[model samples]
Target chain A: MDYLTIIQILDSSLRLATPLLLTCLAGLFSERAGVVDIGLEGKLLAAAFLSGAAAAVTGSIWIGLLAGVAGSLAFSMLHGLASITFKGDQLISGVALNFLAAGLTVVIGQSWFQLGGRTPSLSGDGRFEAWNLPFADAMSKIPVIGPAYDELISGHTTLTYLALLAVPLSWWVLYRSRFGLRLRAVGENPSAVDTAGISVVKLRYAALVIAGVLCGLAGTYLASLAAGFVKDMSAGRGYIALAALIFAKWRPWYALWATLLFGLLEAIGNRYQSIALGDFVIPVQFMQALPYILTVIILAGFVGKAIPPRASGQSYVKER
Target chain B: MNKMPKWADAVLIPLISILLAFFFSGLVIWAIGKDPVVAIKTMVQGAFGSTSGISYTLYYATNFIFTGLAVAVAYHARLFNIGGEGQAMLGGLGVTLVCLAVPWPHWTLALPAAMIGGALFGAAWAFIPAWLQAKRGSHIVITTIMFNYIGAALLGYLLTKVLKVPGSMLTESARFPEGAHLPNFSEILAPFGINFSPNAPANMAFFVALLCTFLFWILIWKTRLGYEIRAYGQSETAAKYAGINPSRIVIIAMLISGGLAGLMAINNVMGEAERLIDNAVEGAGFIGIAVALMGRNHPIGILLAALLFGFLYQGGAELSFWESIPRELVVVIQALVIMFTGALDNMVRMPLEKLFVALGKNKKKEA
Candidate 1:
């Protein structure tokens, strides 16, 4: 209600939205390239675990980040190998990867650390501390505008800014580049792309790689921001990101808006476990269930239609 | 007619995939400095060594059979109903309401009423997703998955806030009345001089699961509705031309699937826990997808797959206790089985098909 409260809410929303934005963009790339990746949850969990573990072992956040991306990339490649090379069902492959990640993280974590399927609590250089933007202190000295900038826009982890920048970058690559053209072509009509002398497999693999990296960053942010990794730490955020992707209708810019909206909803849910509306109390579980319920509403065509890529979820077999 | 044999497709391929998955699971165990052989031995002994062990295994298998059939029925109609978890949760609520609202005079009377309640609740949960997929062009996978989480939250709310027994510390309902409890296997088989583990949760619900499996077979193969479902699944355009309504079939298939999934609560709630406890469905709903996949969406195959998973679950718990292996490793193995038998079938099939072709050629040359 108050301006300070509004700024605080906005701050928390940005913090929460960063991971969703990264993952939504990740899904955008994969789906746009004709791959339906429901394994985003698995990739996030794997990356988060690897990053947190690497950081704990090596005591360097940079190594942790690299390890996380590499781990996630391994899963992305596995998906590609199954869905593309073997001509397997893409959805099933993704589901398998999710199960693999969910199981292996704990199995390996317990074997190594004996910490009940959790890595050591990250501290010192292992965690990503908030960084103040240049002149944030100076900006805070000014009037209303300065305080807003200082409080709402400054002092986030490095990955948060990267997530924001990824949106425009993803938009440009998807709409303005030559590879983007081929990628879009592959999703809509792989035969046409093949006829144009492009390798559909290569294009899809590239898209999956991009998706892997973005998801890796998302996971890294989750672990580093939270200061440690817990079992199933990604929880259902990856699926939530998937819902956000559908809510955005496979667009990059819309992904930002959708994720932020979900993030705002999440922030509200966190802030208010229960709310009094007249004489009735709306429980927090309903708030937690809002995004999923909203997604079902969207998919039910109450708001608008969500038409996927024409060739999405179809395995392309080359004809002689 | 001039192709490979049926046994190779149905039996050999899955056998090879299971072998491959086991091979990888062994490697993972070895990587962790544990004995793979010992792990395997422990799992086997823990799952089937004693009467008690077998009873637990059967108990877990019963849960899988219900959920697996749920998935298989929907899969025949080309629908991927992944919300069995949520549907089962709603089914638990249904069973709870039935047991608590009315005082049944006998278990036999309560059983049928609970079945109706569970099936209806489960069907209601799945109806919206099926409708959306049928008419609005929404993806069934995403909707069903979202519903699973929503169901969990809803069940949690009900158990904690509305259904909690007065002054009870745990987030669960009071135990069901004595008359409402399903008879366990030991009690049921006592007249036949067949002794089952008295303490095991394996109950009359297992027989109900078997009955459902038989009914599924009849509905899918022996009935007119089954013919329509398979016909619609094979080719929607052909079915449409033949006056079959695709939307109607989709809705019908999902309702049946949801009902079957919901029926699993009989085993978990009324049979085992005797109370609507939180997370009683556990991951049985998700495991049902893997079972349906490995079983190739056939009732018989689902039964076999469910038994296999039940072994892993009961065995894995034993391994975790005796050998310090993480219980989640069971999930890894299950996922691998799914990956190979369901998604990566071509990896094994291609080589085997080539072998069969080569063998046929040699036989022709000799002739």
Candidate 2:
């Protein structure tokens, strides 16, 4: 109802959406090339855990960020090789990567961090601080919209900005660039690309590596910027990103809106832990289940018989 | 041009699969500064070293066999019923409810009734997604995963609020009645003075699981329904051409899968636990995926694979008893197994393909 409260709500939503934005965009690239990036969750969790651990040790957030990105990229490439080169199922590869991340992170963390799951809390300068956008704070005091801007924009870590920036960047790469054009062509019709004398395998492989790097950054944001890694910290966000990707009709801008919508619900869920509606109230569990329910509804309405890239899951055998 | 031979395919594939899984997991282990050999060895011993451990492992395996079969049954129909988690959880609830309702007669009527109740409940839960996929053109995989979340949250709410047992902060229900206890073969063994070991439960569910495996195998191979299921899995259009209604088969497959998942509750609630609720299936439902895949969706293979999983389950817990290793190492091993099983077919194909070819040629020569 109040301006300050509205600002607070937007602030929380952005903090939460950072991981979604990063992972969702990360997925956008892999999927743009027609590789279903189910492993995004694994990448996020791995990056988050490794980044947090690296930051804790080196006492530098930059090192943590790099390590996180590198880890995710490496893992994503593994997925690419398995699904793209070996002709394995993309979904299976992604699920394996997630299991690998989930299992490895916990095992290593319990052994190294010694906090069970709680990694040593990073101190001043060990974390990404909220950016102070000039003149924003002053405007935040004015009215309802002013506070909303402050909550949503003024306090985000640098990564949150990167997440927003990624939408247009992804759109440009997918729709405008030659690489994007070729990548889309390969995903749709690798044989045609091959006939055209372009190396379909190499192009798709490159696309996957890029996807890995993006996912890595997303993980770093979650681990270092949002909250440090918890057990299965990526939770089901990777899958949520997949849902977002599908609902986005595989478009970057649409993905942003879809992801934000999901983020909005999550933010609302956190805020309205238990809504006391006069006589009786629904518990948070029902509300927590709302996103998945909404996802089913969204998929039902929009994704029915939607066109996937032509060569999405097909393995190309070299012409003899 | 000629295809590769069979003998090499059979032997080479599983060998490569094992090696890759081990090497890959070893790299992971080494990266974390742990000795891969020790961790793995500890995992194996932890799961299967002693007698009591084997019994407990079998108990766990019995639960997995049913759930894994549930998954495999659906897989045979080319459906990914990830709602095994929800179905099993609901089955647990059903069994608990039945135990609450059925007055404790002898184990004869009580045990079967509990199982039937669970099977029906799980089957009903599964019907929703099956119907959606069959009639509405929805993807069963996505729908099932969604339903899993619904089941988790729904069960949490139900046990915590609407059906909260008398006094417990933990999300669990009240214990079952005294006579509602499952018929314990462990007790039978004790009375006969013919113990497999003092520690192992070695209950009737193990036999039930074996019987189910044989029955499923027969159904898959010898029955018309099973033939249709396999035919549909192979090619839906072809099956339809052959007069098989894909929609009907899809619904039946899911219903059967859910019923099997419900059987998982039979072991835990009727045999193992006095009562069960929220934490009923643990991650057996998910693990069932690994089990079904490892089993190659075959009933006999499922039995063996489930036992292997059971070993992993118990061994993980048993590792704590060992002085040097952490018990949690079992999870690492299980995770490794899943990763291997998922990627293994490619590795295993080369050798197994060779062996199959050789066997085919030998049979031809004899003919």
DockQ of each: 0.83, 0.50
Q: State which candidate has the highest lDDT.
A: 1
Question: Residue B140 lDDT in model 2?
Answer: 76
True contacts kept of each: 0.72, 0.36
User: What DockQ does candidate 1 have relative to the true complex?
Assistant: 0.83
User: TM-score for every candidate vs. truth?
Assistant: 0.98, 0.92
In angstroms, the error of model 2 at B338 is: 3.5
> lDDT tens digits, residues B1-367, model 1?
5457999888888889999998998888998889999998999999999878898899999999999999999989888888999999999999999998887889999999999989999999999899999999889999999999899889888998999998989999988998998999789888999988898888999999999999999999999999999998899999999999999999999999999999999999999999999999989998998999989888999999999999999999999999999999988998898789877988888888889999999999999
| Model 2 Cα lDDT, one tens digit per residue, B1-367 | 3445454443444346646766776776677666777766776776666666667888889988998899988988988787888899888888888888867777778778887988998998899889878887666777787788888888888888867666767667777888887656557577777556543555777777888888889887899999999999999999999999999999999999999898788887767866776677887887788778767787876887799879767766654455333444445555556556664355456455576678878999999
TM-score of chain B of each: 0.97, 0.87
Question: Model 1: runs farther than 4 Å from truth?
Answer: none
